[model samples]
Target: MKRTLTILSLTTSFALALGACNQESPKQQQEVSAPAQTVEKPESAEVVQDTIKKSIPSEATGRIGDASIKITYHSPGVRERVVWGGLVPYDQVWVTGAHKATTVEFDRDLIIAGKSVGPGKYALFTIPGRDEWTVILNKNWDQHLADEYDQKEDILRTKVKPYSLEHPQERLKYRVEDGGEAEAGIRISWEKIGIRLPVAGK
Candidate 1:
């Protein structure tokens, strides 16, 4: 009987030890799993953005006397490339801007370089030169990059001298400057060059 009792006690002690080990294993697993729940994920690739446009739509509008002048064009950056006499060849007609032909709109009758022009929208083209630049106004304002430009459709053509600017202009820009009274100046500036056209109420 003693031997049988000893065997029963041994069996109960072994079962109790095994039960303690099993309970400790679950606690260990919980501790390991709790740390995993608190771990943070990496966020290196979630905060990047893109911001660049090749050709941007730009506008210059101002009123001189009773005439309202508006110029719409696509402004392109210099981007460290050659401008005059290289990208823009001398004596060749250029759209004066990028993508589409630069357009000028007049709300009232005006005189451009002493030539009378009625109120209308016209495409502005230029033949860039080192000393002189030819500015042309065409009747066909709705065109793409001077691809459909025709000399026969030209309304007025005038020569203007290109001047150097003190500071460089990174992007092409056009501005309508009020020249007092019934006069305004149309200025195109890019790189280090400046071209101006004088206009007055007619």
Candidate 2:
């Protein structure tokens, strides 16, 4: 009788332990499966290519003297288009960017062409020519393209010589060359052409 009682107690304990293990096994399996479901899918190649084909909203900035010079615009690519004389005409006012007029902002007063320009945002317009390009800073920085361009609203205009690039630039880019604390340059480059606008911080 004693031996039977002991055997029955051992059997009961073994069954309870087995039940507890079974319950915990399913929970462990669920935890393992959850991570698989949460695995993220990689972006498709077509989606990546689409983004590259579109015009990129771009910005470039620099520090000269006490101000932060900022350039904001959409960068368009040169997909084998004749940029200088075809897509972008020669001698007409261009927005200097694809969608909207490019904006140039100086957080502090700066001098361009020996004239003091108050610290503010201005629409950057350009007249592209074979030999010379006219760079204009207009008061209205809110217009699209050159549609609402009023030369009467121009704050500053300067003619700069255009030079040929040894290597073609695939995308339109603006660069602020930091000459020093007193003098600097703003350079525009696209489709094998380059223009430099001299600026002074003194």
Candidate 3:
């Protein structure tokens, strides 16, 4: 009778241990399977291209004397259409940016061609001519709508030298360089047009 009771107890303990192991096995399997299902997909090449396409026009800054000027231009696309008397006509105003109007700023009042121009933000425009071109600075700030341009609103107008280009400019660009005293020239160039606006810092 004693032997039979011991054998029965051992059998019950083994069955309970087996049941516990079976219950824990399912939880272990669930933990291992979850990471496989939650794996992330890699980004496609098309998605990366779209991100670059949306960010076209970019900006760069330059310092000339006490003045800090921001140069903004259009990044590639449809820029080849920029031509004199076709897209940008002779003796007409053009916003120096492709999408929005480009701007130049001065910390204090500056002079251009012996004309007193106040310190503030201005929209840069140019009137292309054969020998000389006119650089215009308007008090307007915003650019994309194209309606802010007003001829009578011009703050300063000055004649700049126009030079013939040896090679075609693929994109329009502008830069501010250091000039002696408080002065600098704002250069505008694209394909055939090269003009400069001399700003006296002193």
Summarize candidate 1's per-residue lDDT along 15-120 as a digit string, tens digits: 9999999989989999989866666446433654323448689999997668999999999878778988887888899999999999999889988899989999
Pairs that clash in candidate 1 = none
State the lDDT of candidate 3 residue by residue for 42-74, as single tens digits: 532234222233326756576665666676656
Residue 199, model 2: lDDT of 84
lDDT of 2 by residue, 1-202 (tens): 9999999999999999999999999899999998666664454223433236667899999977777899999988888778888989998999988888899999888888678999999999999988888999999999888899999999999999999888988889999877885458898999899998998785
Residue 156 Cα positional deviation in candidate 1, in Å, after optimal superposition: 0.5
Model 2 CA deviation exceeding 4 Å by range: 1-51, 181-183
lDDT (Cα atoms) of all candidates against the true structure: 0.90, 0.88, 0.69
Between candidates 1 and 3, name the one with more favorable TM-score: 1
lDDT of 3: 0.69
